[model samples]
Structure formats: structure tokens, C-alpha cells
Target: MRETREKVQLQPLDHDLAFLDITTEWDLSSSYHDWRPSIAVPATFVPATIPRVIAICNQKGGAGKTTTALELALALIARGLRVRIVDVDDQEASISVWLRYYMDDRPEELRYNLRDLYFNAKVKLSEASYPTDFENLTFIPSFPDLGEVDEKNPVGADTCLQRRLRQGADDVDVTIIDCGPRLGQLTVSALVAADDVIIPVKASSILDMKGVAALQKVVNVVKDTLNPDLRIAAAVLTDFSRSKMTRRIGGSLARAYPDAVILPARTNVKVGEAQLAQQPLRQFAPRETTTLDYDLGARVLFGLGAAA
Candidate 1:
């Protein structure tokens, strides 16, 4: 029995099998002079089941950008399709942190199935993947410290996320990039990396129109130079309240972006609570209208059928 145990312990891990060991004793910082060779893994191609990549972006703040992204991801996963999220917003890191907190707090049944992919130049696609409880849901976690990367460089400076994404596409059915509320390099990079862009507009005033226009310009830039295949997949009207003005705004937007999808205007405290608790609305408030809207939005984006 001792020899058998020793043999089993000495067995090497499979080539594709890996795990994380968060050791604190090792020092990561290097002085101006001290240096050592960093570990390198040969780049391996990761084929994607679906070629579509969606970038949830809007130039305006308070557009429910993160919420929209998370909802869409959760909806797709609920449909039994594999989905992964990429956190490109360095400032908030909202989506990634939520996934971590959910994993930390929830029971196994209630836990969100997600993984994380840190945004870094040297980061391999493998380091970004982690398994979760959901069969079809995966996440690419981000860190709050990523905000520091913003201060050091411009927003779109993290351009390599596109390359990394392309390389990792084969592992999942879809990839959703949660972009920050800025048209900097991060947004630009996301646009460049994605095959489609979903613009979320919060119907407040003429400002939303202006925000959409600005986002359109960025999309054009990405199409004209960076990613010609990139196009607007859908424009979602979030926080839609029952009012004459909101109705008018929705009509105008629908007429302008004929291909855009106008989902039901349903917002609730449960949504805010879900985010606070790091849970998706579908999991936190399955019966809420918010879940229905998200499901409808996903159907429109995926062309599964008419709005739910």
C-alpha cells in the first residue's frame, strides 16, 4: 500500500490538466537588476464552437453596461450553450469581482459557473479559464488592481486581449466582453476583437442618442481599420420605464437602428441585489421581468426566435 501510494503521488499531471496553487511565500517583484527566466508555455490553438464574439459596449456611463453583459451571459448559459465572459473594464472589474464573490458566498447549487481571464500581455489563454458549477457557463475573472493599469496607460492600451481571445475561441461557444464606459483602447480593443457589438442605451434623454452616435463612430473606426467584420449585432434599451418620453425614445431608436432590439422595460431592486450578491438575475430572481427581458434580448441577439 505504501509503494502504491508513493507511485500514485509521483505520477505526472496530464499535459492538458492544470491547477492553481496560491503560494504566498514566492516573491513576484523584481528590483531594477534582479531578474530570472519566466515560465513559458507554447501557444496552442483553441478552436471555438461558434465564431461570434460580442462586445457589450456603450460610451456613456450608467447605461447598465455590466448588468446587460452579465444578464446576456447568464441567459445564454441557461439555454445550455457554453458561454464565457471577458472583463475589459479595468476601473470597475464589476463582472469578474461579482463572479468571485458569488463563488465565495453561495452554496454549490446557487453558485454561478464562471471562470476568469486576467488582462495581461504575458497571460496565456489557459491561465484565464476556471470551471464553475454551471455546465454551460464559464467566466474569465478580472482583478480590481487592473484599474492601476488604466492610470499607467490609455483605455485601449490592452490591445492584446483580442489576440488572446482569438486564440482561445475554440474552447467556448461564445465570448462576451464587458467593456467600460469609455471609448479608449479597451473599448477599441474589444471592438477590434469582437465579430459583433451590442450597444446598451438607457432611455433618459437626448444624451443617450449622443452616446449611441459616439459609439457608432467608434464602431466605424473599428470596422474601417481594425476589424472590418465587426458590426452592431443589437442595441438594447435598458431601464425602460413606462412613460411617454421613454416610448418616444424607443420608437426613435428602433426606427434609427432597424436591426436593434428593444427589450421590455423592466428594472427592479432584485437586479441590484443580484449584483450585490454576485448572482445573475435569472438565478437570483428567476420570475422577475428582468429575467424575461434578458431572455428576450438573448433570443434576439442569437436569433433563436421572436422576442420572448
Candidate 2:
């Protein structure tokens, strides 16, 4: 058998394959600089049998929602599943901008986007779902103007995304929606659209943990009034390295969402370079330890491997 590298064993909330720990050590043995071991993934596990609509959500900005969404989607695609990713956040920093390889810099130059699907009924979901460089992965870009939906609060605004995605993304095995920070119509729309919500929090910030309260409040309201089946599926602690604070956050997430998976996405500074290049970390920096974290996260969530 191969020698083991893990310093500590992490127990998942359940028997499912999920990465609950976020800490890793730097490789002292290597000539190169690398985060040594990825959080353990199980040797075997049953993956999801049906398609999933997962929303990457967090009310706190810079908490890693976009990173989780795009990286997880890429990981799923790498597993040979057809994936459709929707960038619902309209900010310049969102996936809508980072994922502009197939899209024009000028939002108006694009044929279709969130502005078309959400603001105007004439545009169909398929029209906005664009093909990406990857074979099995598709992209749906959102522009700055689309943020108006939060302000306009159009008729059936909350349910509109669910309806569109259900109708448009039916061909894909997984659909990941990257949500903007803040509780409002846009976030509500994503929650309403998703069957599962994956919340990303900064491991170092207790303030980010506090933001979950507001998100959970909104989620409770969504469950009561709209999508009763909606669930908080996972809490991903990003920028994670082992520390007293990270362990505390992980434990707190575990206690709060007893039935949900808690994962740590170990930090990689190369993430920004990947984003600037407008490529998923899987493609840009496949060897990066943090990319491995997202890959293992995808497998764990989908049951692609056994729990470690």
C-alpha cells in the first residue's frame, strides 16, 4: 500500500463522500512549492443518480462563490458529464466577466445574456446558453444590466430563473448557478432555481460566518413560500489553511448544517491568474492543490468516489 500523508482524520457529517477539513501542509520534501495533500476523498462512494441544479451562493462578497461554481462545474465536466453554467452575478468580478472567452467584452455586442432572458420574455433560455471551449460544458453569461432584476422585482421574478433553467438546461447533467453577494431578488431567484445550495465562506473571517445567518433566514423564507425542496447542501470554506479559526468555522458549519456537507477549498494564489486568463483552474492550473480541492469536492458531492 502507498504511504499515507494525512496528519489528521476528518469525519464527514454522514457516510457520504465530502471534504469536511480545509487544512493542508506545504511540501517540505519537494523541490517545488506545493500544498502537499488534498483533503481526503473516499476510496469508493455512490454518486448522484439524477441530474442536479446546484447554486453556488453566499451573501458575503469575496467569499469564493464564483470560484466554487466555475471550478466545480469544470470538475463535473472533466468527469465526462455535460454541464451548463450560468453566471447570475453581473459584477465585473463575477464569472460573467472571467468567463468571457466566448463572449464579447461589450455586453451589448453579445447576442444573448441574462439581460435578454430575465428582462425580456422574447429571449429563450437556449438562446442565452452559449457553448464554451470545453466540449461538454456550456456557458450562460450575465451582463451588468441584468442586475436590474433585483431593483425591478418583475412579476414572478423569483420563479423566473427556475422556469428558465428547467426549460433551457434540460440537456445538461448538471447546472451550476453562480450567485451575487447580498440578499435580494437575484439571490432569491437563484435559491428558487436550485435544488441544492452550496455556500462558500472565507475560513479566516468570522464575519463571513455571521453572513450565513442572513442567508439562512432568506433560505428559510424561500423554503416556506417558494421551493419547499430547496436545501442547503454544503458549506465550502475557501482560502482555507489549518488554524484555530478555520477549525472553529468548520465545526460551527458542521453543527449548523448537521445534514449538510462541509468542505474546505484550500487556498491557491494562482486562482487570480486563472481568472484573469478566463480559464477554470482545472484547465489553467490542474496541478494546483486548491484545484484538487474543488475536484474532490465535485466527486464527493456527486458520489464519484468513496469517502476517506
Candidate 3:
């Protein structure tokens, strides 16, 4: 059967960049028709090592949570470490979409495999794995059905992932969980399962204070009730612009959370554009400003330069 071709113009933000998709019978082809061709380099040529899991979470929406998750996942994978992501947001499957486009725009030789893990109380982690184009990266995707699981199982819902983390999550070096915008049962489960958390705070807004407060509350609760080892490894600053107010909040947050690292604020359009195409910033614009920010953030969290 022949299928009709439809023009899909994807513009993630109000930028001068876009992507075109051509669909044919049993086939699809795409290219960066509007974007400039940029080559991405491997992540610092690190030796073979075990991966680690970091959860990029914040209660405030529009804080670039998923972008942080996917960008870091792709950056780490490019560095030759095996990485996987668990997307816990059922309402907005943003990471899931990015992985799909990432798989699409590849040379078939250097593509990383991405997978998704949906919320299933009864299903084991072994059953949720899916293969992607990238070699070192896999994803556990979340869907709307996850909302059902969240609603039906209230008490034990948050504990499900904790059980899976114990039973599984040791195969790879890193498992990054992109959490929802609010403190729900799923967020609780991710905290219980995670060894560390990466909170991205958008600077220049008092609105972020609420997220910080909520995050701190959860951390205290989890440290007391659940996993004592759970630490606030880093609180990254995102979407930061150059101004006195920006520097003020950035400095304040760094002081308030002295243990956490406050990396520089990167305002890159390529990051948003990649998200619109469901692609990672590294894959779309590797040398772009956003990718550079992610690289630095990864280094700090991974403790590459800091004294050990």
C-alpha cells in the first residue's frame, strides 16, 4: 500500500532553524536541511569504566529538566561510557521523543541504542528494556499508562522503582532519571532508587525558590526515612542569562548549597532546537554553547577535575 507524504515542519522555538521530514512507503529520510552541519567529538576519550545514575529533577516546570537529562545522557555516551535514562514524566514524554529523533539522525555506525521503561508494578525491569540506535545509551520510556499505575497504586507505587533499582540498574555505569515537575509518588520512587540527584535551577526567578524548598524537603525526608546515602550531588543552573540579577542568584544558590556545584548558565538556542527535533544537543549541535555547558556540568558531577 502506498502512503501519502505529509510535510512536517518542526520548529522547537521561535528560532531561524527547522527540520523537514519526507515519508515514503516503508521508508523515511531526514536531514538538517535548515541547520548547519556540525561535527561532534567523543567525550574526552575516557577509559572503560562503570556508569553512574544521576536524576535531573526539579518541582518547577520550564526549568529545562528533560533537556538536562537527554543532553547529559548523550554527552556521557559520546564519552564512551554506557549510559541509560529513565524518563518518569508520564504527562510530557519529552525525552522519549528526543531519543526517537536521535535514533533517526545517525550514520548507523555511530548511533546509540535508546530504550524506554514504563511504570509497571508487576513487570520486572528486565522486561522494560528497549534497544536504540546508540550503542552505550538505553532508555526506560514512560507513557500515559504510567499515570494509571500512579493513581491505582498509591502507597506502594513509589516503592516499585526502588525495588527495581535493587534488582536491576547495576548493568550500566549511569542511569539518569528525568523526573516530573511535581513531587508525586513517582518522584518519591526515583529518589528512593537513586544514589544521587542533580537539581537544575533556573536562575533570575523567585519561582525557583519553591522548587528548591520542595526538593530540600524531599531530600530530608528520604535521608531520614528511605536511603540515607542519597545525596544532593549538584544543583546546576540552567537558562541563565548575563546580568547582575543572574549573577546574584547564581552566587546566592552556590552559597546556600555550598556542597552542591553551581555550574555556569548556558543560554543556547541549539539545545531547544534539538529538543524540538527530539534530538540531543550533542547530536544536533555538538560544539554549540548548550553542549559546552553540559560538558562542564558532567565533568563537575563526575568529579573529573576536583580532588578526590
Candidate 4:
């Protein structure tokens, strides 16, 4: 038995299989800096089974919509799925800044801005795609000029994004769009193209609840008029704290939208830290509670597990 145990311990550990097993105790002895696990693509992995387009949207700013979009994309990539992020938010171009920050620190020629595609009508979607350091992950960087798309083509601006993704990004397993905090042409374009929408709400604010109601009204209107296939997949709470007020607000939100899935609040400082470092949570602090929250949230979003 001792010899058999020694032989088993001598076997090489598979580096590609890095999924969270809630039942197993994590080994903390290993260096956290060296903990990034490669995704092991299964032979049976199918692209058709997953939702093709997901828009992380909220009409209200500071509601963690951008963070949710970024983390969810990372989690999906970690699951051995190919993902492309479309940064449609032109105000801050937060995702674009993150991508630039990442590329500036590294030495790679795979970088292209979204403006190249948005400004030129003849540019193919695949032509604008840029590779990231993460395997199976790519993004179309946004620019401030993206906000002017509405002015440039007022008649068909609402469908510009939809047409672009359909023409160029058909090969990706999933495309996640980070929308600006408003229900304008850009947001409408995203909703029209999305197969599912994930709304991130801050749990402690009553105004956020009102924002959700307003956003839902727009979503319903879009569904009835433009996109019959779009649906509100989930509303996740961000920057949540375990307080009486938060619990009260969360309960109210649950009761208000019974059909919608309300996810647990993801309260962690590492989320901000990762963003500051221009790295995904999985790459910056994989074992942190925030990373785990993103993993659980992704599972729920993709129907991999029960809603948390």
C-alpha cells in the first residue's frame, strides 16, 4: 500500500484541468502567483449548445455592469470556451482601457481598436479582432468614436452592432457585450443582437431597483418589437454586503421579479484590485471569494448549475 501511494504521488498533475470543486479543500501551500490553470478543452465540447451572444447591461452607472461583463468573459474562457468581448460602451471605454493596459505591459503585436471596424463600413468583423494573453479569449477594443455611431448612421444604427457580430464573429463560442449605462442606440443594438442579458444591480440602493424596472420595460419593448429571441437571463447583485438593508432590498428585488434569477451579492475587494492590475480575476487572484462568485455566477448564467 505504501509503494502504491508513492507511485500515485509520482504521477504528473494535469495543468489544464482547473475547475473549482466546492466539496474539495483547496491546497493553500502552493504559490498563489503560479496558480493560473490552463483550460482543458474536452473532446465533446460543442459550440452550438451555449448562448452565442450575452450583453451585460444596466441603465444605471456604477452598478458593476462592466465588472460583471469582464469577469463573466474570463470565467467562460477558463471553462475551455472561446469568448470575444465587444465593448460597445463608448463613454469611458473601460474595457478598451483594460485591454490597452494589458498590452502595453506585454510584448505582443496582436492589438487592434474597435474604431477601426466601427468607422469603416467595409471592415470585416474578423479583421478587427485582436488576441489577448489568455488562450481562447479575444476582444474588439472600443473607442470614444463608437459613441458617434448613432450620429453617423441614424437610420440603421440600432442594428449596426448586430450586423457586425453576425458577419465577423460567428466562429466564437460566445460574444459578451459591455454596454454603456443608458438605453440609447448602442444599448439597443446590443439588446437586438443578444440571446441573453445579464443585468447587474447594486443591492443596497432603492434607485437601482427603479432602474431595473425601467430597464425591464425597455427589454420587453425590444423583445416585442425588434428581437423576439432576447430574454433577461439573470440579475446579479454586485458590491453586496451582508447587512440588514441589503438583505431587505434583495428580498424586495426577489419578490418584485419572481421570474428573473437573482444571484448572490459578490462582495470582494479583489475585484477592484484585479481591474487595477489590468488582469482578469482568475489570473490575478484565482482563489479569492470574488473569483469564486464569478465562477458560480457563470455557472448560473450558462445553466451549468442551479442559480445561487
Candidate 5:
């Protein structure tokens, strides 16, 4: 990815430069004065730690969980890090569907996937890790039938990810799990396996803010009995319009999770087009503000140097 980026003569999009200079006034003008599209960064993130597993989850549908997973994976890949994206969302909208062009080209035979990990103990994580169109970016596809785990929920469903995901993560620099919208055992399994949890909330919905409290309870429970290291590491404000509501939510989250990184991915119309085109937003609309937001997100979360 670094080589590919170097060859392309990367520079900040004109819109991104505009972001560097912005004025604002809002309902919470005094309290939210510190809000910015991108968060501050240091010279580097944590040690180039290998296998820093993260889970992108939100109970609300259309909260940008999958978008957060895919775009952040692409952004990390741009920095030359090996990343694996796991589709734990056993719904129609998993990455398997969005990036079908990249996911559908496997050899003609029975293939292993996330379903096998839940039901078939014989299936190793390596068997399910498949390649995508991008180098150094692996994918673990899931099917709708995998939802049976939620319906039937076999014994020990909660720890399947904790028991399996890390073994496969040994070779990669990061593992990102795209969780289903339901905050059931499946999503709990994701939380159990992660070092960090990124909650992507759509900025337009006040209901989105209400869901955060419910999610916070779940995170506390997961920390107590499951993964003690698990934390709400970041909050992503998706489809940010810089409205008064956006600032309100931003301030609320900052107060709620003082240590977590808060990133605002500005709205872009091309996201759906890229999904329809069967490509990542980073590749389909490299110059869009949303793409750079994801890039800034990946760098900020992983402790990479700030890019111009």
C-alpha cells in the first residue's frame, strides 16, 4: 500500500485543505468550541503492534458499522499494514455483499467462512481467511444462515471469537470485525475478542445518541466477565453535516468517554456509488472528504504519524 501510494503522488484533496480552515457557531457554542473534523495526533501510535484486533459495532442499523470497518481497513492498508476484515454481520448487508466483486472470486469448491467458526470446530481461522482485491487485506465472509447462532445459540457462543480470532491474527498487523446490528451473543462474541470497540453513530439521529447508553451497559458487562481489556476505544460520527445536533452529540460523547478518540467523517454523496461499484470508498472516491476522514481515523487510532 505504501508503494502504491508513493507511485500515485498522494496529496491532500482540495476539500481537505478547506477543512483546515473552518468557522463554527452552535447551540453549545462554548462547550463545543474544541470540536474538529479530525482529532489531534502524535508522532506515532502504540508500538507497531501486530494483531491489534478491533470490533466495529453499533446496535442501531445504518449506523455505519460496515463502512467504518471497510474504509478503516482500506486506510490502514494504505499505510502498508496487513489487515484482516471479518464479517460477523450475518445479514444481507455484510461486506460479502458490498464488496462482492472482491469476495466472490474464490475457487469453485466448498469454502470455509464465519459460519464454520461458530458451528464447526474443525474449521481453523486460517481456512476462513480469504483474500480480497487488495493485497495485505484479508476477509472472512459470513452468510445469512449464520444468524442461526443467534436463534439457536449453541453453548459457548460468546467466546468462540476469543478462542479463535487471535490465533489467525498472529500474522497480521490488525484484525477488524464488522459486527451485526443486534447486540446479542454474536456481537458479544465480537466484543470478547477485541482489544478495542469503535462505535459509529450517525450524526443526524438523536436516537443514535440514545442507543449509546444501552451499548455502554453492554461494554461494562463485557469488561467484567469477558475481555477485561476491552474498551470503547473510539466513537465515529458518521455522515457529519456539522449541524447543531452534530456538535451536541460530539460534546456528549467527549464527556461520556473522555479517553476515547472521537472522529467526525464528513458527509459524502459518493459512498453509495462506491458500494454499488463493488469497490472500497478509498479506491472509488479517493479525493472525497469522507475518504480522508477514514484515513485520519486509521492513523489516529493506530498511532501513525499525521499526514498532510
Candidate 6:
């Protein structure tokens, strides 16, 4: 069978300039100043020695999980870590689309959908992964047929992703899973497979907060039963506004998950604009405030200096 292709214009980036100016051009004011200092990294902090599996998950649609996953993946790549993105979201497949936009020259033979991993975990993962234009980054594209896996409810369906990664992705420094916006078998598999989960919440809406609460319950259940090592790393606030209600919810979230990190709302419109352009925010608009927010997030997640 032939694969569907969508052509998009690719943007050229000055790699030398981007790498040199990223840290100097970063503006810290865009982050919530009140809470930024609290998570600041110490001079003696050290990143984890082994690879980590992170899942950017939220059961609510439009909660910025995909955006967070992409930005965080870029940040890790910038730090010289090998990262792989697994698109488990059968519906949107935004990450796969982003890769396709960047690499229009991708060969038909290299195009393999993540759905293949369900039937043949190890072999499909090794065969499906394609390299992006960016060094140290690779991803497995998603296909609509991935939705079919949910219906099968095959034995060990919940652990297929984890098993595949363990077998085929041992050399990867970090693997970020972009889960679909529902608590289905796929999402459950991601949660069970992940070492840590980052839940992106939209602070302006109370409904999103409810979604977070429900997801937290599922995280608790998974940790207790399926994966004892699983942890809720943080709850990131996306498209955050400084409205009164936003502040109220932010305060409530901080109080509720006092131990877990609650990242400041990253409000820059450039985030969405960059996504539409099929580019990472840092690569497309390095000096943007939202890019800095993502950098901070990546640092905090990896035990690197938050203020770096």
C-alpha cells in the first residue's frame, strides 16, 4: 500500500547563530517570576546518568501536550542528548506531520506507522524510526490504523510500547511519548511505560483543571498497580493568561500538588505560530519567551539547572 504525503515548505535556520545566541537572548521575565526562583537549580545538581522515558499526557484535547512534548524534545536535543519521539496519538499524529514538513525528501521506504509496533513490537520499532533533519533526534510516524489497536485489546496491550522501547531503543538518551487525548488503552500503555509523566493544563479553564484531577487519579492507580516506578513529574500550565481566575486555579494547583512541580504558564502566541509553521519554537523563534519557558522546563525535567 502507498503512504499519504503532505507537502510543506521548509524553513532554513542558521545553526551557528541559533546555538550562539540561545542562552544570551533568553529573557526570564516571561516566566512567572513569583515561582521561578523556587525551582532554581543548585550549583551541585547533576542530571540522571541513565536514559529516561517521559510521557507528555493529558486526557483533555487542546491541553498543549503535543506542544510540550515537541519543545521539551528539542530542548533535550540542544543539550546533546539523543531523543526519540513516539507518536501514540492516532487521531492527530501532529509530531509525525511536523517531521514530514521538515523532511520533504523522506523516502517512501522509510515511512512506517507506529501501528506496526502493536503487532510486532521490537522489529517494527527498529524498522519504523526515521531520522529528522536535526541531529540526535528520530521519530516513529503514526497512522490512522493505530486506532485499531484499541479494539483488539490484545494480551499485554498496555505494555507493548514499553516492551518495544526496552528492546529496540536502548541507546536512546530519552524517549518522549505523545499520547492521544483520551484515557483509552493507548494512553494507559503510555502511562504504564513511562518513568515520569508531565501533564499540561490550561489554567484559564476550570474544565481543564478537572481533567488534570481525573488524570491524577489514573496516575495514582497505575503507579500503585502496574508501574511502581511511575511518577507524576509535573503539571505544566499552557497558554497561560494572568487573569484573576487563572491565578486562582494556579494557586489551587500549587496547593494540591505541593510536591510535584507546577510550571508557570507559558503565554507567548509564538508557540502556536511556530507549530503552524512546522518548526520548533527555539529553532523558529529562539528569543521568544515561550521558548525560554520550554528550555526551563527541559532543564527542570532532566535535573539540569533550571536557571541555565
Best by lDDT: 5
| Per-residue lDDT of candidate 6, residues 116-189 (tens digit) | 77775445676777777677788877877888878787778888888888876576899999988878888888
Candidate-wise lDDT, in order: 0.62, 0.75, 0.61, 0.67, 0.76, 0.71
Q: On residues 71-141, what C-alpha lDDT tens digit does candidate 3 reach at each position?
A: 77765665556677887877655576654443434464433221122233556565554445566666766
RMSD of each: 18.6, 10.1, 13.2, 11.6, 4.9, 6.2
Q: Candidate 3's error at 144, in angstroms?
A: 1.8
Model 2 RMSD in angstroms: 10.1
Model 2, 272: alpha-carbon shift in Å? 2.6
Residue 52 of model 6 has an lDDT of 86
Query: Candidate 1 — what's its lDDT?
Result: 0.62
What is the full ranking by TM-score, best candidate first? 5, 2, 6, 4, 3, 1
lDDT agreement of model 3 with the native: 0.61
TM-scores, in order shown?
0.72, 0.82, 0.74, 0.77, 0.86, 0.81
lDDT of 5 by residue, 68-152 (tens): 9999988787777888988989888788886444334456454778888899888888888776667788888899988988898
* Model 1 lDDT tens row, 76-146: 77665677887777655467666553344435443322112223445467555554545555666655555
Clashes of 5: 1
Give the range of the ten consecutive residues with the poorest summed lDDT in model 1.
1-10
| Runs with alpha carbons beyond 4 Å of true place in candidate 3 | 1-51, 100-122, 306-308
The most accurate candidate by TM-score is 5
* Model 3: lowest-lDDT 10 consecutive positions: 19-28
Writing each residue's lDDT as its tens digit, candidate 2 over 34-148 gives 4233343232322344488998888889999989998888777767788888888888888877655555433554478886777778888887877666667788888788878
Cα shift from native, residue 58, model 6 (Å)? 0.8
Q: Residue 203 of model 3: what lDDT?
A: 67
Model 6's lDDT to the true fold?
Answer: 0.71
